[model samples]
Target chain A: MPLSSSHRVSRRNLLKGAVALSALFAAPLIVSAPAAASAAAEQYVASIGKSILVVAGGSQGQMSGKFRNLMARHAAISAIGVFSLGKYRSKLPGSQKSEYYSLIEKFVAGLFVKYAPQFAGNRIEITGSKARSARDVIVSSKVHFASGKAPLEVQWRLLKAGSGFKIFDVRVLGVWLAIQQRTEFTSVIKRNKGDFGALLKFLRSK
Target chain B: MGVLFIDMVGMRDKGVTGLSRLLAAFCIVAATAIFIAPPSTLADGNRIVIQPVSDDGLDEIEEPGLDDPFEGVNRVIFALNDTVDQIVLRPVALVYRTVLPRPLRKGVANFLNHARTPVTLANDILQGDMKRAETTMVRFFLNTVAGFGGLRDIAGEAGWEYHSEDFGQTLATYGVPSGPYIVAPILGPSTPRHLVGRAVDILANPWTWILWDATTLESISPTLGETISARDDALETLDATREGSPDYYVTIKSLYRQNRESEVNNGAVLEEELPDIPDVR
Candidate 1:
C-alpha cells in the first residue's frame, strides 16, 4: 500500500469508476420497481364507498365518531381547501382559525351522523368510476333502500393523496354537499356583519 | 268541392311543367360549359375540389353570459328560500317520505304529471312543435283511458315517452331573452320573461280553470301535492348538495343557470362542454 503514490491514485480512481458504473446500471431498476409497486397499491374510488358503508352501519353517536375519524384521515386537506373561509381566513387569529376549522369538521361529522341512519340497511353498489383529472375521480354508486324504493344515485368525488385517494365531496341526486355548506356559512358571516368570531360561534353552537 | 279539386289539379300541372322545363335548360347549359372547359382550367378546378375545406367559420360559438343584474337581491331571496326549505319544506318532505308507501307516492306523482298534460300540450303548440303536442295528447289519452286517470302510467310502460314543457321554454324558443335572474319569493327561481310565461301558463292551464269555481282548498290541493312530491323526490339530492358544496349559493346558481340554458337550447349542449363556474366566495 505504501509502494507508489501514482499507483495508489490510479487504484482509487478505478474503484470510484466501478462504483459509478454500478449505480448507473441500478438506478433505473430502483425507480421502476417503486412505480410499479405504487401502481398496484394505489387506492380506488370504491374504497371510499366501502368506508362510508362501515360508518353508516353504526348508531348516530358511534357513527359520528367513526365519521369524524374518517374525515380526519381523508377529508381534512380538502375541507380546508374548499370551505372558502374568505375574509375569515385573514381576519381570524391563527388559534381561532384552527378552532373554527375543527368545529366545522365536527359539524360536518354530525351532519353525516344525522343523515346516514336513513340509509342504514341499504345496499350501496358502486356502479362506475370516472376520472375527472389526474388527481380527482368521481365514483358513481346506487343506494338501494331497504324499503325497495327507487335507488338513489350517489357520486363521491375523491382526490389523490399520497398513494391513496380520499373523499372530498359527495353528490347525492346531483346536489353537492360542500356547496350547500358554503352558502349557509357565507350567509351566517354576512348576517353577523362579516365577523369571524360570530361565524366561529355559530359553528361552535352547531 | 269537385270544381276546386279540378282547378287545383290544373294549377299543379302548369307549375310542375314550367319548373321541369327551367331545370332542364339549366342542366343543358351547365353540361355544355363543363365539356368546353380548357384542360388547365379543369385541373385548377380539380385542385379546388380536392382542397380541404376550412372549418374556422363553422366552429361552435360560445353562449353569452346570463343577465343577472338582480344578483344581490336574488341572493337574499335565495337565502330566504333555503331557510324556508330547511325549516318547513324539508321537514314536511321527510315526513311525507317516511309515511307514504313508495308505490303510493309514485302514483301521486304520476297523477300530478298526468294532470299537467294540458299545460305541456299548450306549451308544445306555442313552441310550434306539433309532433310533441300530438305525443302529449296521445300520452294523456292513453294514460287517462287505460291507466285510471294516470294513477298508473300505462303509456309510459308501453314505451311512449313523456315530456314536460313550460311556457318559459316556449318564450325562449320565440327569442324572448331571459331578463335578469331573480329568486322569486315562494316560486323560487325565475326571470322577467319566465315570470310572464308563468302567468300566461297559469291562465292557460285547464286544470286551474276547471277548479277555479271549487273551494280554495280544492284549487290549491293539486299544486300543494305536486310541490310536496317534487320536494320529497329531491330530498337526498338536495341534502347531499348542501353537504358537498363549499358555497351553496354559487353552486346552485351555476346549476340553475346551466339547467335553464340546456332547457332553452333543447338539450343540444353537450354535458362535457358545459362551463363549471367556480364559487365566487
Candidate 2:
C-alpha cells in the first residue's frame, strides 16, 4: 500500500512540559537537519514502510526502479530503528537470507532519492506531537504528497531507547501495517508448515 | 477549613436538599402519569415495528414506476456512489483481483449462489426454526469471510449478489408502507423507513459486533478504515452520477425506484428512460 493508501487503510501533546526533558535529551541527537527537514525525512520513511507492506502482500505490480528507490529511502530509517531497538524477534537483521528485509531496504533507499527535494526544504511541518506514555510517543506530521493537495497525515510511534526513542511502529491510516504483516506472516508460516522461504518467494514473484 | 465545611453543610440543607425534594415530587407525578397512560393510545402513536410474516410466502407490493419523478435523483446518487467506489475501492479490488486470478472470481460467485439456497432450505428445515438460525449464523460467518475477505476473487467469480436486505425491505415484507422517498446525503436512495433500516444495519453489522468483542484500538482500526474507505468510494460514484444529470434528484429517484422494483420482481427489464448524456461523446 502506498502511504496514501495507509491513510485510506485506517493524538498527542507533549508541550511546555517536554521543553525541559527535550533539552535533557537534545545533544546526542544526530539529526543535523532542521526539525522540519527531519520530519520530512521521517514521513518519507513511513511512506516506504507502507509501500513495502503493500507490495509484499502481492497486491501491487512491479514498481519502477525509480519508485523502488524512493520507497527504500523512506523505509530505511525505521528498518534501522527496528534493529536498533532490537527486542522484537525479526528476520530484519538477516537481510541476506531474508529477502523481505532486503526488499524493504531497497524500498526505503529508493524513496530518499525521489523525495530529496522535499527534504531539502526547511518548510515541512510537524505538529500536535504527544507522548502516549513514557515509552510511546505519537507524532503527527503534515507533508505534501504528489497531488499537491492538502497536506496528508503521516503518524509514527517511537518506543523508548535508553534515553531517546526508536520507531517501534507506524500506522498508515489507522492500521499498523507492520503489525498486520506480522500477524499475516505468523498465520502464513503456520499454514505453510514453517516454510517461510516458499512464502517469501511467492510474495516476491511476479 | 472548619468554617468552610460548616458553611457548605448549611447551604446544602437550604438549597440542595430543597431542590432534591422538588425534583423527587416531579418524578413521582411523571411516573404515575406514564403508568396511567392507555396501551391503545400508546399503540396508536407513530411507532415503527417489524411485523411477523409467514415463511411460506413473502409479501408482494406495487412496483416502483420507471419514470417516477425521483428517478433522476436515484440515478445521480447511484452514479456518484459508483464513482467513489471505482476510484477508491477499485484500486484495492484491482490488487486483490490480481492476486486471486480468476476464473476464480466467477467460480466463487457461483459457490455463494449455491450456498444461499440452503438459507431458504434451513428456513424450511427448522420450520421457522431457531435451531436453523444457528446453522444460518455459522454459514453466514463462513461465507462472509470467504466472500468479503476474498472479495475480488470471490465476488468477481461469483458475480455481485446484492443480498443486502434493509429494515425498509423487512418492513415492506411485513406489509408496512414505504414512507416518502428521501435522498440521504452520503447514504444515497432511501425512503424514510429504509433510512431507519440503514441506521439499524449500520449498528448491527458483524464488524460492529466484532468491535464490541474486542474493544482495543488495534482491532478497531482496520474495520473503521475499511468502512470509511468503502463509503467514500460509494459516495464518489453518487457524485459523478449526479454531475451527469441536469436534474440529479429525478435521475436518482428514477434509478433507485427502478433498481428496487427490479430487485422485488423477477420481471422483464425496461429500457432506461433518462435523457441523453450531455457531455460524454
Candidate 3:
C-alpha cells in the first residue's frame, strides 16, 4: 500500500492521460449536438412538406383518410384545442375533450383539403430553420405550385419530442393559424356566454 | 420599423450624439414595445437578436377580425375587378414584363421605391422609428448618389435592404382601427383607414406636390408603372390563390387584413420578443 514516489507519479500521470483522451472524444459530440438538432429539425420540416405533397398528389384536392391521419399524427391537437379555448378551457365539457380535439384536427385538415387542389403537383422547398429553444424550431419554407405561380411562403413552428418533432403552430403571411383560431374561438365563446356548444358549432361551420 | 426590423440598437453604445440619443429614446417610446424580426432574414451582421418574450401572444389576437359587413357589394365589386384584371391589367402587365428585361423591370421597381422614399421616410419619422428612418435615409442617399437616380439599387448591394413604410401602417401603430374591408374598384382590397392613409400619403409625397400643378402626363405615369409591376410580380401567385379558393373575395379580404396586422407589428427592438414578418421578401 505504501508506494514509492516514482510509482505515485506514474499513477497520477496515467489518470490525467485517460481524462485528456476522453475529453478529446467527448468535446466534439457536445459541441455538435446543437448542430445535430438543427439538422434533424430541418429534415423533419422538409419531410412534412414532402409527405403532404405525396398525400395530395393522388387526392386531387380531396382529404383522403391518409391525409387526415397524417395531420392527426403530427399536430398537437389536444394542446392546440385547449389553448384555443383560452378562458373557456375549463368549460370545454369534461365529457367532450376528445370531441373538441377531433374537431380542431378536422378544422385544420379542412383548410388543407380546400387548398390541396392548387397544391397538388406543387413543390415544397425548405428554406431554413432556427431554434427558439432546445425544444422549438421555426422552419421556414416555400411552396411552388406546378402552375408556374410565384412561391408561397410557409413557416412551421415545431416542438421537439422524443427523437422527433410535433407540429405546434404555422405562420402564413405573418398570421399563425392557431392564433387566428384562438381569436375566433374565444370571441365566439365570449359572445355565447362561454357556451362550449357554440364553439363547436363554429368549428363545424369551418 | 413596422413589419420586420429592429435596427440602430448599438448606436448608443458607439457614442452617438446627444440629439440622436434623444431621438432614439423617443423612437423606442413610439415603437410601443414591438418585437424584432427574426435573425434569419439577413446576414449575420444585420441580425439583431431580440430577447424579450411578451405575455401570451393571445392577448394580441383577441381583437376582432376586420369587419366585412358589405359582403354583397364587395363581392360585386370584386367580381368586376377580377374581370378588369383578366381583360386589361394582366395583359398589360404581361406585355410590360415581356417588353422590359428583368434588369429593366428591376430598375423600374428600384426607381419606384426611391421615388416613394420621401413618404416612407416621413412615415418612419411619424411613427417615431429612428432606426427605420435612418435606414430609409441611408438607402435614399446611397441610391440617389450611386444608383443613377435609383434606376439601380446600389444601396441594396451594399446590404442596405429596402423596406417601405406607409401612412396606413403608421396609422395602425398608434392604435387606429382598420374599420372595414372594401373593394375599391381599381385599387382592389382596402379599408377606410387605408383609404384615408393613402390620401395623406399621396399628399405627403413630393412627387404629388411637384406634379399637382403640372399639365403633364407625368403624374399618372408612376401609378401606371407601379400597377403593372405589382401585377406582373403577383400574376401567378394571385392566380393560384384565386383558382384554389371557393371565394376569392373572402380569401383576399382575410389576407389583406392579416398582412396589415403584420405590417403594424414590425418595429423597435425588444430583447427576446418575436416580431411579425411580411411574406413579400
Candidate 4:
C-alpha cells in the first residue's frame, strides 16, 4: 500500500499543479465580471474622493500620515517607482534602491497632499467607468470647481489588490502622472551620462 | 478688398491653383490646427468600444511610439513656437483668463465647441461610427436648442458628452500612417497626415463656406478664440509641466503619443503589458 519515493514525488507535483490550476480558475472571482468591477470601482472612487476632501484641508505635516496610510494602502507605489525609471529601470544602482524607493514614496505622498485640495474641494462626480482588463478598471470622474474654472478630469486606473483594488496610475489634465515622471527621470539620467544617481539627485532636488 | 480679390484671381493659374489654395488653407490651419491637435481633449469623456481592426489579435497591435523622424527641424520649430507662446500667447491667455468673467469664458468655449458639432457629426458619419454619430446629433440638438446656440453644453449636463472628432481620426481608423511630428508655427504639434486631415476638416467646417471672407478666400475663423480658450484652460497645468520638465520637448512628445493613441482607440481597454493593475472596491 505504501508508495515508492518516485511515486510520492510525482503525486506531490500533480497535487501542486491541480492547486495552481484551481487558483487560475478562481482568478475571475477577484474582479468577477466587467459590470461588477465597474460598480465596485465607482464605489471605491466615491469613498476615496470623500475621504481626501475631509482629510486634505489640513497643513502638510498634519495630513501627511493620513495620506501616507491612504497611499500605502491604495497606490501601487513600488510598481510606479519602477515604472518611473522608464528605459533606465535596470540602471538603478542596487545600493541606492532603498533610498530611491523611500524618496519616491515621500515625493508621491507630498504630491498627494499638495494637489488634493486642488482636485477635491469643488465637487467630485463619478462620470463613467471602464474595464481595462479583467482585474484593471479605469473609473473616470470629475472634480468640478464652484468657481467656474474648468473641472479636473481624472481617470483612476485600478487593479485588483488583495480583496479589492489599488490605484495603479492616474491620468489628470490629459497627462499620466507616472508617464510624465518617466520622461523626466529618464531625461535627467541621460543628461547625467546615464548615471542613475542623477535621477536620485534630481528627485532629491525636487 | 481689391488686393485680396486680385490675389484670389491670380491664384487660379493652372496647377498653381491647388498650391495657392493649399497655402491659404495651410495658413488657416496653422491657426485652427490647435483645434485638431491630439491634445485637444475638451470632452467630458467618451466611452468607445474595443473593436478589432485587422485579423490579428489585440496583442498584435504594436505600441505607437513617438516617431519624430524630423527631430532636428522639429526642435527648431518647437523652439520658435515656444518663444512665440511665451512672448505673446501665454500673456494673452493669462490676461484672458484673468480679465474675462468665468461665465463669459465658459460661453466662449461652449460656442466654439458648438460651432464644431456639425464638423464632428460629419466625421462620425464618415468613420461609420453610427452610435457616435447618433450621440453627436443628439448633443447638437440639445446644445443648439436647449443650451442656446451651444453656449451652455446642456447636452453634457444631461450626460451626453461631446467628444472631438475629425478626418484625421477617421483616416487613422482606416489604417493610415501619420507621418513625423512637426511643431507648427504658433499652432503647436502636427504631422503630414494631420496637415492633410486639417485641410479636409477646415473644408468640412460649414463656416468655411457660410462665412467665407472672400477678401481673404478663407473661413471667418474662431480659431484665434479657440487657441486662446485652450491656452487659458491649460494655463496652470502647462506652466507646472514646463517648470518641472528637464526637457519640455520630450515631455510634450511623450504626452502627445499617449494622447493620440488613446484618442484613436477611443479609450478602449485592450489591456496593457502589466496585466493586472490594482483596483478598489
Q: Going through the candidates in order, what fraction of the true interface contacts does each contain?
A: 0.05, 0.00, 0.11, 0.28
Cα RMSDs, all models: 20.6, 29.7, 13.0, 11.8
**First chain TM-score, candidate 4:** 0.74
Measured with C-alpha atoms, the lDDT of residue B133 in candidate 1 is: 90
- Per-residue lDDT of A73-96 in model 1, one digit per residue for the tens? 877343443344423334456566
Model 4, docking class: incorrect
Clashing residue pairs, backbone N/CA/C < 3 A, model 3:
B3-B266, B50-B272, B51-B271, B51-B272, B52-B271, B52-B272, B52-B273
- Please give, as one word, the docking class of candidate 2: incorrect
Candidate 2 chain B least-lDDT 10 residues: B7-16
In candidate 3, chain A reaches a TM of 0.77
lDDT of each: 0.59, 0.38, 0.63, 0.65
How should the candidates be ordered by TM-score, best one leading?
4, 1, 3, 2
Q: List interface RMSDs for the candidates, in order.
A: 14.5, 26.5, 10.5, 9.9
Candidate 4 chain B least-lDDT 10 residues: B7-16
Using lDDT as the measure, name the better of candidate 1 and candidate 2: 1
- Residue B173 deviation, candidate 4, in Å? 0.9
lDDT of 1 at A55: 78
TM-score of chain B of 2: 0.40
TM-score of chain B of each: 0.72, 0.40, 0.72, 0.74
DockQ of each: 0.04, 0.01, 0.10, 0.18
Indicate whether candidate 2 or candidate 4 has the larger DockQ.
4
User: Stretches of candidate 2 above 4 Å error?
Assistant: A1-98, A106-124, A132-136, A144-151, A159-168, B1-281
